[model samples]
Target: MDHAHIITELGHANITRRMLATHYAVDSEDEQLVRHIRRLLNRGDLENWKQRVHALWVTERSGVLNDAILGDVVHDEAMEVRTHAMHLLAERKDWNKTQQNWVLLALHDDHPNVQRAAANALSLHPNENHIRPLIQVRETTPDNDPQWLYGMRLALRNQLRDEDSWHSLMGYDFSEIDAERIADVAMAIPSESAGDFLVWMASKHEVKEDSLLQFFRHAARYASREQLNNLAHLVPRKFPNKSELQLELFQSVRQGLLERGEGMSPSILNWGSQMVRQIMQKNITSGETWSYHTIDGVKNTPNPWFLQVRSSADGDRDSTFICSLPAGGESYTGILRSPIFKCPEQMSFHLAGHDGYPDNPRQKKNGLRLVDSISGQVLQEAYAPRNDTAQPYTWNLLEFTGRNVFLEIIDADEGAAYAWLALGRLKPEVIPFPELSPNEEGKRLVSAAQLAGELRLNQYIPNLKEWIVGPVPDASVSIAAAKALSRLDEANLPARLSDLLQHSGKLGTAITALRKAMIAETHTTQRALLSEMVGMLPLRYQQEVMNLLSNHATSTGWLVTQIKEGRLSPLTLRNQVAYSKMESVVSGDVKILLKEWKDSLPAPNHLLQDLIERRSEGFDFQNANLTNGRALFELACSQCHQIAGEGALIGPQLDGVASRGVARLIEDILAPSRNMDPAFQVYLITMADGEVISGMPRREQGNAFVLADASGQELTVNLSNIRTRNLVSQSLMPDNFDELFDDQQFTDLVGFLLHDSSH
Candidate 1:
């Protein structure tokens, strides 16, 4: 609106038109219109208190507020007019002492908003008079009232210049009054000067220990990046001999910076390196020194109580233990994380309670995880056995000595019975690896392959050379073993490997291992790779595979008879027409054997129901071939399961099957998932590279998950490199029992489980 029309509206007899004119004049952004409205208010034409307040607003909005008019409105009997006047006064630096006293007196005003406005105004020109009323308002206002304190802070900002100023401003001599109260008031202020006062107070050894955490919290929220960096470097320099004070100050600053998203500062991290080595002995003073998290409704989360400091000999050499079992019966699952620190040469800890269950999948859920804080990968991990004692564990951190890392103590089991892992203090100390004889070199694939090449044990040459030709679970493992053999005796490796491949028994043994590894594999690509490895061995006339077929001894007895009588040259029996295929070839003694194998277990449900109903009935072991039963166990179960130390140890062991009775054994064969244990449940893992694997679950490294299929073949995959991880309800054991054995073979398998007492 034009100035003439706006002035007409302001002079209108109607109060509504006058108010509307005031609103338009304020927002019109026209300085001339605002001055004209100001003139109307000065002349008392706008008589309503609201109109006077709004006219004042229009003056300020258009950068034409008359200080004399605003000064007059400060006590206009209308709180809104006075409040707006006080706010405008607060922003002025040129207000005189009388004007300052006007604001200071408003600080004692009954209404909080007006008092705050006055307090804010007085902050710009605070004097001895402003301090008293500012403190009075602060004292009366709620402690949680942020605005009061913030306003009060401005009035107290000059007081935070140094230690003496703060003590004097607090009106108490440091020694005569409560040191605690001094700290209380000092820590509440947020600014670099306040930080300076805090540091200076620490220098005088006057900072109360009780208020230190709050001080740290205050600094974390408001301290500048430069101030925090100074707290790390300059504080230590000033207090060179006060290491304890230095550490506390450094850690406090370091933690504050982290919480503020000031990513880790190297100097700050270095200042705490020596202290991170003392978690067991030192107490955490910050709100959350460790990152505590939970799954499945875990309770009694990490606090001072969760981080328990024990007597040196309490748990057979303890200092501190991160206790997950807060109330002693919670089957809670949680991960306790330590602050990030550089890894020392070595770190050792102990587990004083159940870290895992024996031979159970829950065993995989509880353990300590040493994580790479930089890359977020798990370098290594360790697990305590299923015993309630202090089980010492030491991780070799030489590989990551200089890298920043944090440790996680995980207890993820929901079983109430002994369901916690009390992780002892992690101290940087060495624990050397125990010596293992070279005689152990070829006994296990993993240990052998890793140690043999490095140690160069010549005795492993025989086993390594045999594995080189083919039939190994992974072609890479075979290659590694071959390389290991070369390291042992490069001169004789090729000949030994060639000779081992040409032998039927050894070649068959290697091929058998490869096939079993294939059985444990769920991925077709991996299975196909194993199959191609099988072709590394040339088939014989009576292929070595003939002896390895699933329990054919009973049906093929006559073939041996025919061969012995010269009626059949079994070695040259090409008329039977053996042919090579990627899939396992199990030729029976007659055509019916192949037909029976083709229809193996078409409907597994019918067989499982029948076996469950009959229990152990109709089993005539008197006619059952005990010798053939052992052969059947080797053929079918050995690949994925173990019995009497003869078969692959990849899957669940079958040592206690005989005690389960005949009916249960029959049901187990037909219904693999009927009553499967969680330890044997399948986990499907998709890797970051898009490869997928299914296997039984095992302990997880912070950055990796270990998976072992029913065949007991295990693989540790990087957790950070995983795209997806899912728990499959089905057991890892395949559901094709009937396909692997016929009536006699099945009967013999049942006999092995039912009557073989030693198994």
Candidate 2:
């Protein structure tokens, strides 16, 4: 109704406040009324009242308030009030002592919002006097804090043009500063001294690697031609193993020097350009090219033990040396010789073994050997058991000087075995050699064990078993090796898992292996063994193990008991029960207990449906915590939908979503499948192998189409492999969010989505 009446009702309703502010802007010229409004704005207790005051100030261009009153408002307890006060101060043609002091005070404010406002205000009046205070504040503040970062940038921007400012900036200990921010400021400053300081920082060995990399990148963009040449020379020594960094640095240097009509040294140029080309091509150096040969008078048969050059069986197109032996072939021999080179301290080659035939107890034996061609002595040997998958093996030839070595594949058994070998000299810096460090040997062994599992070579089972039970102190390696062993041979897995469980130190690993086995094991006998083993575990492990086993009919009663006892979380129980395919085992007391538990929890479906039907008609927006809602949105929705450029671009951005109205937003969240954008529709691509993958189509790149899955993982499927593409009627966004979160959580989430602009 009347302006005074609306002003009186500001505390009662948000709409009243808006109407009052609008009326004050257009019609009110009364000084008493302006003072009254200013007093109301100064009252920081009212939520967002300062924003309404700011709206009135903007609409009512005439300044009814003096400097003192505005200065007092700048110190208001609310951040928005202080921010708006700073904005008003920035509009002043010349700030007085009081306003400058207030601006400086706001700069040191703990809130990033006030600090950003202060920074913007200071930018309007860029004075050298502000630099010292900014630097002091930055030095005392934590490096990770955004305030310190913004303060540093603001300080640098104000003083960057002055050559002497570089000295002041460089004098401070930058170790406490974020390297990325330092680089950003350095890049912004156009002074040559700033460039020199960055180059100096880059050259320092004591600098952190992250800082060094950042400094190097910026220096490349800003440094002089002489500095670039110097940096080019140091690149090979400083970052020899970092091919990516080398490529970046080289490109930067080449571009920078070319613009200045200067060039780097021939050797540096050649090395850098060659490395860039090599990295772009993804090429690996196969040392001293090896040639394959069969033993003389061994009767080279095409059916078994024949040497052939072929593409790597692992899908890598690199040429590999393959030695094949057919089933029922016995006593076959072959040798692969490397050209003589000044042999290093050690040389290694990748070897993978696969049995062409399936698992059979009657299959014959197969073995591979490495020998020195000069001495005709076996350096290393391996033998595979029957029914083994392709297994990867590694061979290291040690202490061979100027002598060629031979790789021998011998399939002496009646079963077929194939060996794939690829020789490449590994840089010790890039690839860890087990012999180099005892501490790292465990990690290397773990990698080797995993590779063996990937190749499905059952031949390494005994070695892996020894590693698991051996004196190797690293439990992680032991666990990994045990997992590899389980993958190779499932028959003895229960016994191995039981042995692993005996070591309390490896309980975590044992539990992991046990869980995997339980999920994969289909045999009733194996499941029984798993049950027995799980029973033997300690009580603490039993809860989690039983949770995994909850899908089994035998374990449902145990799960219900745990749930009733408060030992199991409701969320975990709900997830397990919902997804479980176990035959109905709940009866009598157990069924009653489950029903009681369900009744005690908030029913998601009913709550969601009611909220959707009611819309915002009966919703209590004032009580909802927007902060908690933002957290929930980040946890659940941020992966796909972005709001204000803060999340992934997999889905539509929710910026200005308030314009869509609460009802529409609710409907969108509750029923995402309705009236969905055709572009956001999920596509189910069936591969030639019958595997189905569903995701929102991102783009078509070359022969592969990229798609973003619900989990935010991007998948690149080859067009050739896709047998059919079907557009799904449903949205990629999961529909169970309503079921997943409680009513308060759902309200908070929607509140956050509505206030997207505020965030």
User: Which candidate tops TM-score?
Assistant: 2
Clashing pairs in 2: 359-387, 364-414, 365-413, 389-456, 390-455, 391-457
Give the C-alpha miss distance for residue 673 in model 2, angstroms. 41
Give the alpha-carbon lDDT of every model: 0.55, 0.55
TM-score, per-candidate, Cα-based:
0.32, 0.37
Question: The CA-based lDDT of model 2 is what?
Answer: 0.55
Expressed as tens digits, the lDDT of each residue in 418-486 for candidate 1 is 667676655763221112211121122433443455444555555554455433322334545645654
Clashing residue pairs in candidate 1 (N, C-alpha, C atoms within 3 angstroms) = 90-121, 650-711, 650-712, 651-710, 651-711, 651-712, 703-719, 704-719
Q: What C-alpha root-mean-square deviation, in Å, does candidate 2 show against the real structure? A: 25.0
Residue 360's C-alpha lDDT in candidate 2? 40
Worst 10 residues of 1 by lDDT: 575-584
Q: How accurate is candidate 1 locally (lDDT)?
A: 0.55
In angstroms, give how far residue 291 of model 2 lies from its true place: 12
